[model samples]
Target: MTQPLPTRDTIVDFIEGIFLRRGAESYLGEAVSMAQHMLQAAACAERDGAPAAMVAAALLHDLGHYTNEMPDDVLMEGTNNYHEEAGANFLARFFPAEVVEPIRQHVATKRYLCAVDPAYFQRLSDASVYTLELQGGPMSGAEVAAFRANPYLEACVRVRHWDDEGKDPERAHPPFSHYRPLLASLVTS
Candidate 1:
């Protein structure tokens, strides 16, 4: 049988368990561990003075990597893990649209940036470059137009930037507990 869902009061603990258990894994061949990458992304959002919900989005953006059923080598083996959708859908259970939508759209935002700015493509790490192909490469003209129309476009882009910047292995951010209150504040009952 499936496990019971976390209630509003216990959701933070449930999420914290995820980080503690799955966060130590490699972040898709990035220099940092998964937890480090996510914490660092949240740090970037916090440093940039993003709204609390955006900061939460940046923190939890890659949660699908933890929640998905795919093996670690899924991307390397030529499969699209679709982590963005998995993560956003999971977060939708407990978060507002402002928080979940950015996570959902972050991968597309990467594609959007690649289509709009050639230089952005050069900045992606090797793994990201590989995944970009799996993610449908850059946006086509119509795709770009649809992406532009998303109300969360700017937020998605900002989260993408943080996702890129968050791979620095040496950078340190506060632990998950530091953001627990912020997360709790945004959790829907």
Candidate 2:
């Protein structure tokens, strides 16, 4: 039998299991561990006054990486594990569509941004750039139009920008307990 979907409390337990055990976990190529990277992203969203659901999405955007068991060096091995898609699908079982869709499309938002803004690519971290090529380089004109048609594009972009910012190892942020209520509020069962 399949496991029951996570509730607010158990989700926190899941977070602790998947993220907290690691030591200084590197994100793709970030100096911080996976937990730190996620916390940083959620902190940015909170600082910018994002809605609670968006903040939750930021915090859990890479749930797929943990769930999929993708290695930290997946990018180095020249694979696009499509962690964004994996993450979104997994989260859908627990979150509302509003929350899941942005996680689903955040990586595509990166590609769309690169095709539209020359400077965006310059700001990408080395690991991000490496993954970009794996994600299919920049989007073409047709691809941009297709991406624009997605209703979740704005939210996805916001999460993507915060994903970029979340790489910092030294930023101050609240602990996981601070977000528990928000997760409970957003989860629909």
Candidate 3:
């Protein structure tokens, strides 16, 4: 049986009291807020002509990090495990497969693409590079071969790109408050 959805007030309180605490300075870097980062990723996905589900996935990809404090070891290891997986797991109860799967597989996709596409890893931020090593580095030839064989490769790649682009602070996107409507819709439906 499906679990009951969280109330809109509950979600808002969580986002405010937990996720977006300190006005984005604490969670985000010198420039952007967590909300801004998420919106930028969603915009990037939209610009790249991704599907609605994928865009939503991009928008909510980091939800877990804000909602729960993840382990530093897991964050550093970069092993197909991290905030993305955590976020996906949390979202699965409320969202459909199309949304959850993309979030779940985003990190793996990033790793796979970095392994196969030489140019991909080159563009990663210094932070991402350091974390990649902990996450087990790039996939092996055998791993890449197997990963590329998956049907969701394209979506994963798009999500990964957006994931990177979302880091910039200069990008224009809606505040986290904007998603309240969408969140409410999901909860009520």
Candidate 4:
């Protein structure tokens, strides 16, 4: 039989365990580990004076990477893992839409940025560039317009920017415990 799901009180710990167990893995060949990347993203959001929910979204934006079943190189092998949707779906169970919507839209924001800002595409890391092709290689005019209509567009872009900056190997980041209380405050259930 399957194990019982974690209750609201225990869900935070369950998430923490995921970090402890898997965060040390490489982040798609980036210089930082997955946990470090996430923590740095949270740090960037927090440093920029973002609201609590946006900071949380940045912290957990790539959570689908952790939760997805595929190998880390799945994107390199030319597959759109759709980790953004998976992460947002998982987070929606416990987080409010304010926190979850941005996570869901973060990937699309990448494509959107590429379409609107040529420099943005130039800034993407090699792995991100590779994944971009699999992610449909930027938005068309109609796609850009539709993305601009999203209520969470600004928040999603903020998270995406943090995601871009979070991969710096030299950046120092706080421990996950630093944000545990923030996570607890945002839990919906």
TM-score of every model versus the real structure? 0.90, 0.86, 0.75, 0.90
lDDT of candidate 1 over 69-155, digit per residue (tens): 323333333334477877776678789999999998898999999999999999999999999998899999999998899998889
Which candidate tops lDDT?
Answer: 1
lDDT of 2 by residue, 22-54 (tens): 524667677777888888999999999999888
Compared with the true structure, model 1 gives a TM-score of 0.90
- Tens digit of lDDT per residue, candidate 3, span 1-189? 112334444644454444465345433332566667777888888777877778777888777664334334333444444677766766665667777777888777878878888899889888778778877789999989898787777777888899889888677876666656655555423
- The list of candidate 1 runs beyond 4 A from truth reads 68-81
Q: How accurate locally is residue 32 in candidate 1, as Cα lDDT from 0 to 100?
A: 95
Structural RMSD, model 3: 5.5
Candidate 4 Cα RMSD after full superposition onto the native fold (Å): 4.6
| Model 2 TM-score (2 dp) | 0.86
In angstroms, the error of model 4 at 143 is: 0.3
Model 3, residue 162: distance off in Å is 0.6
- Give the true-structure RMSD of model 2: 5.0
Q: What's the lDDT for residue 82 in model 3?
A: 60
